[model samples]
Target: MGIPKWMTGKILCKTGADLVNATDPELVKFIGEIYYGLFRGGKIRQCGLGGRRSKFTIFPHMVKKLNTGLHVMIIIFLCVAIFFSLVSFGFCILNAIKVPYRAINGPAGACLWNFLAGGFVVLAVTSFMAAVKLHQLTERIANFRENIFRFVILEERFEDCFWICVASATAHAVNLLLIAISGIHFPKIKTKTEEVNVTAEDIMY
Candidate 1:
């Protein structure tokens, strides 16, 4: 999902520099405050000294500054998660309306899709966190397209949008648990048995 336009306060990471420590006046001008929100497409606000403020979207504006590969991976995983969640919902509706095939009867189909969705959600969150921590995402975003001044990360934290994904993952887990608690056993693998000739003589022996 994309970031909401109204969610300006849902900052994912915040970065600031010590203006007093800057010896260069031009550098001090660029050193104020910056924060990035959850989605890359969301609005990122950069405030400089003397109340000079500029706003830009993170996707097209800061794409060059981010770890493009990891960022793309996170997006792909999120899309997949959404797809699987919808598939699970469809399965739930199917179960309520009609009798399904043996392979997907009861909670089995829903559970499978939920598991996949939860897995992808976990992957997305983990990859995003890795990109943020290992690649210094906030600092990169804060300093995007700037040649004169660089911003160091002063403070950073996961915000509401990140937690929303976490909550979705938790909901998937709870759904699976509820399915189990309802006494519906997950489908088990069945092995094929070879037919053998039975003789009365063997039994007598």
Candidate 2:
């Protein structure tokens, strides 16, 4: 004997179509009704002629939908990222001015290089961490929205936010390496001995 086919409308799954097909008819019908209408007491759908698939839910229009509060929140995060980046860049510039000194067991140009490098390393590491965290936070927020602009672009548009972080962090790290290189200097003795000049006479041939 052949199995009977269901005559109801095509089942759509919040999870996926397979799960929808697997659900019991009564529960399926109930969920379908809830998703399709029961909550709002409406049953209206329209077929598109071509291209864009736009499904409009009517209940939302009944009330004034004034605030896209989430968009502002994402903008705030972007500002923070920009702020940190600027601050990091400032430190890079700050390190560009070298105070060359030569004293064993004391300050040297290399010490300044190392100090600047440490700052770069710290910023780069923190940038990586911030990018990762921001991407994740955006991911969770993206799922709740229907539009991309309403959530952080780090998540809403990108399927996986971790890659976004990786790219941003890589660039920042490269920039830091360049900055570290820029801050390096040849050793110079800032301690004054009124120019001690050594000639061939000082060295025995």
Candidate 3:
């Protein structure tokens, strides 16, 4: 999420009549091409000004400026989610290619892994939302390393990358439904049996 070009235009127009005959070359150039922050995946890129392309990652680069603990939590949850998703994928391939132990390769196992992945994805999303909304993440990122110009957020929205995470969560949920539809039985239900009691006298006889 980042500031839009229209927002920059609005801000420049708000600077009064001087904008019409701005003598400062820098100010004129800035009006022509304003700076905007764009967040994509793990990195933030500076765009829309003087062909200046500056990029940096969330880790190490901007960690000091962000809620480090919350950021780390988000990363950890995402990593765990990816691991579980991979495990589920491998289990699916195994189920298709060869017979495997029920504990590891059945619909139940798939459901378990999918559930775990979905849970972590939810955690990651929630944590990131908190970091962004409650903590002013985009504003913080936009202001990072700026010595002169200050960037104020005019509008912010989740970009495609963020929605992709949402889509992944949705996919995991759909996988759970598909696994259930595949006729999954609880382990206890599958192993249930009637028990017979034999008395000592019957045994002796």
CA-lDDT, candidates in order: 0.68, 0.35, 0.65
Better of 1 and 2 by TM-score: 1
| Candidate 1 residue spans exceeding 4 A from truth | 4-31, 37-48, 184-205
Clashes of each: 0, 0, 0
- Per-residue lDDT, model 1, residue 165, is 92
lDDT of 2 by residue, 1-205 (tens): 0111101122122333233344554333322211111012121111111122223232354112312333233334444555655655554455456442333212333344334444443454344344325434222222233442221221122223324434555666566466467667969879756888888988864
Among these predictions, the greatest TM-score belongs to: 1
Candidate 3 to truth, TM: 0.64
Off by over 4 Å in 3: 1-53, 184-205
Clashing pairs in 3: none
User: Which consecutive 10 residues in model 3 have the weakest lDDT in total?
Assistant: 5-14
Candidate that would win on lDDT: 1
For all predicted structures, in order, the TM-scores are: 0.71, 0.28, 0.64
lDDT of 1 by residue, 34-118 (tens): 5455454322333343544556665765776678788888889999999999989988888889887755656777788989999
lDDT tens digits, residues 120-191, model 3?
989988888888789987667666676755555555666555577789999999999987776856566466
Worst 10 residues of 1 by lDDT: 5-14
- Greater lDDT among 1 and 2 belongs to 1
